[model samples]
Target: MSSKIYSVITGTGIYLPKKKVKNEAFLDFKFFESNGKPVERPNEYIVDKFQEITTIQERRYVADDLVASDIGFFAAKKAIEDAAIDPETLDYIIVAHNFGDVKFGSNRSDMVPALAARVKHKLKIKNPDCVAYDVPFGCPGWLQGMIQADYFIKSGDAKKVLVIGAETISRVIDLHDRDSMIYADGAGATILEGKESSSPVGILTHKTRSDTYRYAEMLTMGCSYNVTEKNKNDLYLKMNGRRLYQYALETVPLSIKACLDKAGKDIMQVNKVLIHQANGKMDDAIIERLYKLYEIDEVPKGVMPMIISWIGNSSVATVPTLLDLILKGSVENQEIKPGDLVVFASVGAGMNINAAVYQF
Candidate 1:
């Protein structure tokens, strides 16, 4: 008999910094323009593009003093509380981040273990059995982490899994670069517990696609083979926006359709569509194309687009943060119904795209 693993999102939480950065604020910043000259703020362009595509007003980030893990801690606390599961019961903690707390030759492999210990200590969980590790992926980290946790839970290796996607993309960005304007920092967490039911409310199907050739289209770090002694700014998120847009527009629809097909579901059956929140314009263009191509009526609505405008892209944390906002009644009185199919999709710097279907 095949062992069954039912993965359910028992709890969800997110953390953002107290500071708020508005579109108008960008105009005042010296770095917004070249040679210290004032230039038209990019916020208007972003907003107009986003509003046409997504339903988002604001996003969040981490405070100046805090790192990605700090935000992760806050989100984890909320998820654990929501699940009513003690920290002591958690058998494993998986942290997903592309931007970790590594600086100039010093590594922080202990970061996850330290975070787990802190949570365990604060909760006063005596002699709790918990192991912590980190998983790094450009954008699919969160969903992939969920899949990893599901394997352990289904195999009876772990009773509970605390999975978090946290990122401090802001730290890696060269503030002078225009790309920095679209990067932010935040964290989100989910609690996964084993269930006896064969059917689960989370992670029904997941599909991943990567075109390694296009990997160079959006890269940060320099490769060892082609050693070019560039400045520090070269080590930031760089992208051929047009190429990425083309690839995403072409690939995402098929990927989403394939996932739904694998799950034996239809596009119209889905209630909400949650993507990586890459940008407002790109998302809108894809949605428009999908509608035209599929000829599907009643396209799902009320997506979180403004979050990217306000908080920029928080890398791996984007989806979970948006989910937290939706769950916490931040999505303008929208109610999630039973059997509602929610789609999670992401496209990131790896030239990687993934789509997963979840029913709740």
Candidate 2:
């Protein structure tokens, strides 16, 4: 029998900015009236409500000198080192991002030179045949890139791929916007290489779904609505928390279960569930519902590890960062052993949801 070939994640890396913004920093944040009058909420009220909703205590922001691609290059270098692979041998470089790279202090997004191409240049990979591209699937873009790598390996079209998710979201967020508190800057990457194997040891199956018609506007980046703001032209992320909350509550759990079903695995077989670090409460609720779907009376502890409280949401970077942390034992008391089933899932701005089943 022909041996099975699998695209397995050989290594992972992450880059988080040096600056950390704590919840208290938002105490003086201004909320404007329709007339553009500055209205201030008490610090306690603001922090309490934010914690109650998103459960984020702090997040990171890029240094004044760096851009998203710069951050991603650092991560890519480390990922290549971890994988112990020469950059010249990479078959492809897939970069997933939302805002290409908002220049240090401006919202001017640079897209002419794609982030992947920039990283490839920065890595100094000499092979012109090493293809590089970007995927902008909102927050799930990184996972989508990894999924694409899996298919490439499966089709004999590629041998090794570098998948990266990086974002400098702080640049796109309005300083006065409440949603600003929920966004951060960071990057994560994984090196996937095709290898011949007898058993499934890599990406098994995945399910991706989108509902743009219904939730397209739920989370968006656009000009500030406040007429009082000096720069109405300034764009920032705006989200309808209630709508997104409802949508995630309804869609994510089922998407995960469906992915597991596609992989012909039971819920109990999954050792780690690395979900998008979007919201703490929402993630907890989703895990609970997933357990209920399997008719389990109690949710297992450590099944879902969350870093949102400290990292906030770095869009596409969340899952890979969290995965890298756990894989490297940076996360206390958590580790993924060989032969363990690891499930990766996320829901993002495209109103897109995706889940992939993998054997570690």
Best by lDDT: 2
Backbone clashes, each candidate:
2, 0
Clashes of 2: 0
TM-score of each: 0.81, 0.97
User: On residues 1-360, what C-alpha lDDT tens digit does candidate 2 reach at each position?
Assistant: 567998899989999898999999888777653345564666578678988889999999999999989999999999999999999999999999988978876887888699999999999998998999999998999999999999998999899999999999999877665667899999999999998988788999999998988788888876654654567777777788788988998999999999999999999999999999999999998888888899996887899998999999999999999999998988888899999999999998879999999998
The local distance difference test score of model 2 is 0.90
- Cα deviation of 242, candidate 1, in Å: 1.9
Indicate the residue-level lDDT of 172 in model 1: 61
Q: Give lDDT tens digits, candidate 1, residues 1-360.
A: 444667788899888777665544444333433233434556567444444443434545456567666677888889999999878788888888876653332222335455545545554667446877777767778877887887888788987999988877755654444444566678889998877665556778888887787454565553222123654224545555567778888888888888888998877777777788777777777766665566864345663233575666777888888788887877665656678788888877677778888878
When summed lDDT is taken over every stretch of 10 residues in candidate 1, the lowest stretch is 223-232
